[model samples]
Target chain A: MDKVVKVAVDAMGGDYAPAQTVKGALEALEERKDIKIILVGQEKAINAELNGIGYDKDRLAIVHAEDVITNDEAPVMAIRRKKNSSIVVAMNLVKSGEADAFVSAGSTGAVLVGGQLIVGRIKGIDRPPLAPLIPTGNGVSLLIDCGANVDARPSHLVQFAKMGSVYMENVLGIKNPRVAIVNIGAEEEKGNMLVKETFPLLKNCNDINFIGSIEAREIPGGGADVIVCEAFVGNVILKLYEGLGSTLIGKIKAGLMSTTKSKIGALLCKPALKETLKSFDASRYGGAPMLGLNGLVVKSHGNSSSNEIKNSIIQCITFTEQNINDKIRMHLEEE
Target chain B: MDKVVKVAVDAMGGDYAPAQTVKGALEALEERKDIKIILVGQEKAINAELNGIGYDKDRLAIVHAEDVITNDEAPVMAIRRKKNSSIVVAMNLVKSGEADAFVSAGSTGAVLVGGQLIVGRIKGIDRPPLAPLIPTGNGVSLLIDCGANVDARPSHLVQFAKMGSVYMENVLGIKNPRVAIVNIGAEEEKGNMLVKETFPLLKNCNDINFIGSIEAREIPGGGADVIVCEAFVGNVILKLYEGLGSTLIGKIKAGLMSTTKSKIGALLCKPALKETLKSFDASRYGGAPMLGLNGLVVKSHGNSSSNEIKNSIIQCITFTEQNINDKIRMHLEEE
Candidate 1:
């Protein structure tokens, strides 16, 4: 509680840049006393949004960046060229050990590129996976490699399992989280080549509580605490979860308003239904973290709201306090 | 209306086996005048289930098969060893032109193996894709390669697009269905190695209407009529849709029954809510068809009820009447 964790925020990233980013940082400062934020963007835009916001001057600071990177540009080219951009400057802070972490609601490509290229990878890490917490029936599960590396080798998945375990057990405080590989069938032998090759490696893994293959149907019911997959499959699962949840919820709302009697029922059932559905709302969770990097980098959604940005910034406290990167380094080295 | 479409039903397949399978065949005969079902399973079990049931004997015939290929057995080993198995025998009927189609609520792997090894892939077809019509917001979209042909090459995906187009347009009566490759992002460059290579080939193809990439999020919104992907990605999408749909529906029911006030409201809203939810129920859609095969092969869910089995049988008529195979052959040759 005495020690403070400093996080650098990319104020020029995302759809509502500077405004939402600044507001979110201020909100984080108001909520927690053990965290500090450095907002990186153009001085005029950052100061204009922070004009009237009240916060402890000791906990908040601003660092100006001269350039901005758009989502359309090639990520590698942008990251390499935009040396003074918000994302670049913020990441440089982490790389130089001036900041404990870097948070961005920017172009996913740019963040991923900068996280690996600028911040660099840890000694034993092959690929730094972007792990996100998704809401489930019982609770939340960490889905590793949601949008990081694709066409990942079997060895990459073994590392994902080990790294995911470290995050869930240490950061989330789960006691030996059950790690499951995403598969089409329940059987071990029933998967594509990558899964077939990865299954045995995961089974022999002593660092994690490795469960066997989990079918996609079981994921929503909280079948496992840490779900592992290559980026392509993981990306599909993550996006589909959001899409189908909203679609079904929309259909339910329409059904409730279809008739006069049902409308009356909708009124009575609204509160209880809303209370139950609140747990499944994914925005309550923070952004995905690029694990195995030298320093922490969390990528919030491009369309992130102020609340989401606040949550993303606040979660960095736990990620730092628990010394997650140190634990990951030890676990991976042992493996 | 003019010619009888003969369908061979695997009575010993599925969880319920002869009881549900026999009942489904009878139900299909009652619903349509132009379809004939040849029930292939243990003669005694099928006859026992058929006892005291009134049906036209001319429309339904029994072909006894003593062996049943179970879900646990290796698919290739089972299909090759158990020559008299229901899936193998039923597929043989279609292969010999004795039946227009083969429908089974059996092991998916066995059906996929038998469809290729016994019934054979259509000449020039690299791999036969298992395309299922999934319910979407607007109507239904055909998801190609849901389970079969994992680790697919770029060429296999190109054939899937052609075959899916033929099935959706001819059998489902959609004119020039829009084909979309499933990707994480809308942009062409935003996919794994497989999709990146396949995107331009699809764009260049003139036979089918290629609507670039469709993200998994847009899939449930009826974004595209024909969704194409490799088997692994397609299977995850398919299974997750079933999983998330049911989990949310279950949670909604628990919410509706949480309080006494909500219970009274639930009583008033039950009918309208049920009516709306009925359209989203995937059971109304029949089994997945292994497309680009020489003969029609439908792989129904193992847990299929009589209604689902009946729907599976009834769909074969459309496949036969529209001459789907000839259409697929013509389309593939043009490519």
Candidate 2:
């Protein structure tokens, strides 16, 4: 009865692509009635994978894309040259207003480049930051500029704070999300030049709820709702968070399985332990979004499975429903 | 029988000052015969704490100092004005050749600033870096520039890699230690301008073994012996490493104590679990040394315990014995 929110998905992206992407598309359609998917990839390969999945074709369509972008290819070159590539084609659909959002589980660089060069930025947006929701003990914290703009200025960080606050409030439904700049120390005088310069700017900004500086150690403790930094620092934090979490989980598993006594203990507490660890699993939260863009561009992991893919596709619906880009544009314009 | 390595310790530094510092000095004297300690602090407080502990009085001497640097004081101004501050007095002992090394469980900024201004840099050394040995599953990896100079240039990172390599080989006893730059991606070309520029410089250097770039996710796996980065990135890595380890350990303990069954199992596996977790403790490794200084200056944690302080004091012995600064001078001369 209502206009369908069309999402263009890169079917050829990710490690479990075509099959997982097709399956995810089917799942998204089955779960939501007010959404349509345009699977961009090789026609035959996508069709073969979609044949067995029992889903209504009315909600799904295949857009033929001839090429696939490899992970190692230069982002700018690939975006410029690979016009028919799955990632590029998906972004083109959003650019032409054929789709409301574009989702990819491909090369992070390509998605970021394509998102900017293809779909373009909202007016007054200085630099678009890739903001990801990282799992914390209490709930989730949004880390802006995970790996988009490495050499961001203080004004860029201020925009990140505003946009990150908007994302948390509208899509994730957190009211007055506390925003903080990632820094070496909590003091105003601490951190590098970027942080020192941005601290006062963030404090001065009346648009968002700025909570001041936060050290990396307090991030897992759920101290701030939105943690902002330049891409370089944010990327390091995100990678380290995932690395440390996975490594710790692996060590715990190895410790539990090492001896018979531990094995018995592990078996006894398997259910609860699994639940506890599951709370920290980032994959369940879906992909990071390249914020401040005209249309939604979500970048799922390269090794994303069908479940992660399904969740990422479903995540786009919330962004569309909440009009996140519109809100970002409004916020940017007000400044 | 050999000449004792005299260490000048800031007895008035840290959260648990005089008491913990005196306790550590006593413990170090009892454990090693090859070390003498000059405790710098208020004579009354030092003697009061020292009187409670029995140790070799001849090997332990207290040098009275009236001032103590607070954490909030400006580093440069504090170093300039606080002439007789505990940290400054201790460092002066090293500079005057009365002590081979200086150890401080004090404000990191004061220690760093004093190390540069008082102790001075080794000839040919461009910049001093803070190198901390972090515990890894394989053993320990040297994280250079944990919190020294921030917003570092490519040249500084090159010096870090060289200094870190020297420290790893000489102090840590790693042969031709593999040095790797901390980056977002493994590829040499895939980083910010700083990393990209430093990667080639490190590769061209013939003095130390240089491995390519390493992602932060692979840091815990012991992928590289020496992980080099600018202070900002290095500090983030070090803090996150400590945070994640403590958080995981806390989670494990809480989980084990949750129920009667788990509590009983925890008791059974207590010894093995403790042994496993002990390897990850950052305190066991002691302080981070401000490398490339003419005299050894170690910066212990602000909340360092007696054992950590003792361990740090003992660590300075190895640094002096191995002549790390002289070797750094030789390495820098070649450049």
Candidate 3:
């Protein structure tokens, strides 16, 4: 029998919460027999959602938590006060080795805070970056330090490059993944003082394929496999990527709906267009992992659907089996 | 009779210099009878493009500038060493009070450096921000400090809001334009240190309509009239906005071309689709102006066509007529 990768899921987090989260966990069980899910939330609500779903009863379990965190609540304060909160309880499972990984579609602040304070960071890791895979023209590239570090030092960015490279190479299966620092210009000496400071350090590092500076324009062209920057810029890039994507798509749909002839054309082109668009969807890749943690902590989108949650949970199997933490440890602690 | 606006065109700057620059100048002269232009570049090259163009010769004149600045050259060094470079010569015309404004489609770095060093900043101004009008769902909004002032302070940002508001109100005819600081989250308390420190200052300032904070996701939906951020984050947003716009359009076009039926549909829908896409085309808004300068300096896109160049030149007329510098002085030096 294949070894089970236990995933402690935040059952009360995200928009859909108990319904979509419960459905996603069950779908994961149906897709793969080598996993078990411990749903952490209000037991009554979860059981109500899970009553009719047919699955191996022994594989799926629930750990009741009385409190739920809202998007508006302060993450650190909520985590401290609400010990039985789903996010806190779920993170504790990973900390105690009861689960190999933790997944949440909860408040990003709560997860980031809980992942650090509850699950703990690996030794020698200066900062654990929230690295998400953004879809590019050719493929996906990992955007490291998307939200975790602000006012990041050169050392922090250098570490982001290394950790990002390790994730891209092992998880995404990119060989000797090309890494680049996000900057305003392509030249070595260009960019703010932080980039100028980090450029040489990234260039001299022998372990990773450190390409020079990458402008934001080059990012969508799949210019580099691993894109590194401080949290401030990275967060802007990630959000704008989604914003512009939706805006253009909205414009295109309106364009198609403008004339009757184009409406017929839309009918003929819908399937192929959907397939092509799906290739560019970031959710197909799964949630952003909090790299450098002792085990694993993944933050899915707040409004994720069942498919996204299933993909998020499934990605944990690969992360756990590949030993990404061990690889990050080997790469970052080399000094 | 309307007062004549004198604009010194950098005839040697941009992708299609001498040719598109001369043509755009002629087009502007034809469009408005109350404007005169000084074309600065190699005399022979400027004359070659001007020989065939039919326009009022008195309205369009060429001033010979021997040296040319390339995009690859460093801004400060090139501005200093290339004594007779077109950018420098054209800027000198404004400094000498011969021309009201200077417009270029050449190197952005060169244009920014020349705007500060050559034309000089308005007295009492801390920093001159490069503010560009970006196309939005409703109309256009100004993005200040897109490329200038990377290591910006809160005081500089506060000025940017005031200056941006002044430009929007006078030039674009916007009334008390809403200004927002770019941040990771919308909450006042949530942001990088720069944003956190700057938020309350914006809230307290009674001059502009201060909307608390704007996430990158809200930008494309016409979230605010003046989106504020330091240069690093602003630059990323600007480039990423253009980059993602092109990428999605590319995907959608490919989607339409996948099948024969859709190909016919594309042919039928081409005109309406083009019209829809045209509204979101940022090039229609022309170039970014280096605000707070004594004389106007506008930087058009590097790869701009004649139409874009013409628009860039025409925009200077409105900016000069509105006396943007005088208003900037009043707003920023109010305290």
Task: List lDDT for all candidates, in order.
Answer: 0.91, 0.87, 0.89
**Inter-residue clash pairs, candidate 2:** none
The prediction achieving the highest lDDT against the true structure is 1
Error of 1 at A104 (Å): 1.0
TM-score of each: 0.97, 0.96, 0.97
Question: How close is chain A of candidate 2 to the true chain A, as a TM-score?
Answer: 0.96
Q: Which CAPRI quality tier does the interface of model 2 achieve? A: medium
- For every candidate, the chain B TM-score is 0.97, 0.98, 0.97
- Superposed on all Cα atoms, model 2 deviates from the true structure by an RMSD in Å of 1.9
Give the DockQ of candidate 3.
0.70
Worst 10 residues of 2 chain B by lDDT: B267-276
What is the lDDT, from 0 to 100, of the residue B122 in candidate 2? 86
Q: If you score just chain A, what TM-score does every candidate get? A: 0.97, 0.96, 0.97
What is candidate 1's CAPRI-style docking category based on DockQ? Answer: high
DockQ: which is higher, 1 or 2?
A: 1
Candidate 1 per-residue C-alpha lDDT over B1-335 given as tens digits, one digit per residue, 9 for 90 to 100: 46999999999989998889898899999999999999999999999999998999998999989899999999999999999998888999999999999999999999999999999988899889899988887789999999999999998998899889888888888998999999988888899999999999999998889999998989999999999999989999988988888888889899989999998889988998998888888889989988888999998888889999999999898888888988898877775
Measured over all alpha carbons after superposition, the RMSD of each candidate to the real structure, in angstroms, is 1.5, 1.9, 1.7
lDDT of 3 by residue, A225-284 (tens): 999999989999988887777777788778879888777767777777787788778778
Tell me the lDDT of candidate 1: 0.91
Please report how far candidate 1 places residue A90 from its true position, in Å: 0.4
